[model samples]
Target: MPLPTPPPTLLRDAALFLDFDGTLVPIADRPDAITIAPGLLPLLERLQAALAGRLTLVSGRAAADVRRWIAPLEVAVAGSHGLELGTKTAPRSAALEEGLRHLRGLQAEHAGVLLEEKPLGAALHYREAPGAEDACRAAVTRVALSTGMEVQPGKMVFEIKPADGDKGTAIQTLMQRPDHAGHRPVFIGDDLTDEHGFAVVRDLGGSGILVGEERDTAATHRLRDVAEVHRWLNDACEEMS
Candidate 1:
């Protein structure tokens, strides 16, 4: 069955929030090559001022990585999926020291695989080493189950992160701020990691827009691909300008 298209009013009334990879930037063969368009940063900058600073890029990448991708113009940036929270009002570190301590042991166990530790969480990426996927998941799951953390699955990685910090938590935190207090929230992304963020916006009387092929969408709307996301963004920027 075809899902109904969400109205433009959803974008109009909402505070626009987005995810980076697979949402704005196309997924790359190498994750490092997911670059934002040259004009995108400047367009987003204009939108921010038009929206009265209501734009945010909520991503799983580190804050520094997000900065590198979209430099010069600083929108609200939440990196490490909701782990490293940074906004004008509050700057939060990962608060995951204990989680990291445990992850190091697991990293040693899976030394050949990529174990990335970001400020908010730790991930065992198996994209490059598909042979180790099952073992990596099992190892990460063991840690999550024993340590009282939750596991988040991304494109080709398994993450064990704190139950507390998620995209929902990040959105709720943003909504509570004085500058954005009255605005509705709209989150957009594509990936299993984006579910928490979709839920956050829905619960806050906002909406979620999913990009790409649909599963059971917590998202209220959907777009075909990253290009569509860019088109919508361009439209929004024009409207705001």
Candidate 2:
């Protein structure tokens, strides 16, 4: 199916939501292995200025981590699948601690499986151990169920997070804020975890742009890859200017 073309002058009044890893930068085997593209920070600064600070990053990474990656430029961010909102940190719980321990043990047992700890959750990455998907999923799922955490599956990763909220709730919450309120929302992301954000934007009379390959998606438009995303964003910034 063909995606609809985005309006030429959408950025002036749009609330933009971006996903981090796969959408803004290419996914790496290890999360820390990824690097931000040159000139990307300046582009985002311009975009945020163009959008009147309504631009936000919604990602599975911690907000602090995202800030660290894009140092010297601060923007609103919802991290840990919306477990942490803005600068407010997600509270740690015994369940999350226990889940992390279990995940760490699982990572130790499986070669090439990497464990990423978050403020409110943990993730098991199997990018280097493609054959261990079943085992990783099973292990995460078991721990999540036992600890009453939510299980989120993404491209080559399985995450155990709090069941309290998701990307949809994150976008919705941002929409109600003074800065984002009354603006049209446009969310762009890749991965199943982003589907919730897409649905929320569509429900709010906004649109979603899917990055990367075609799949079952709620996004109305598509960009081929990170390069295309940067191009489209640059165009939007230009339009606003």
Tens digit of lDDT per residue, candidate 1, span 69-185?
A: 787777788887866776432322333555566667766766456677665557887776777789878867876776677788888888887787887788888888887788889
Q: Which candidate has the top score in TM-score? A: 2
lDDT of each: 0.77, 0.88
TM-score for each prediction?
Answer: 0.85, 0.96
List runs of model 2 lying over 4 Å from the truth: 87-91
Query: Which residue pairs show backbone clashes in model 2?
Result: none
lDDT of 1: 0.77
TM-score of 1: 0.85
Give the Cα-based TM-score of candidate 2 against the true structure: 0.96
Least well predicted 10-residue stretch by lDDT in candidate 1:
87-96
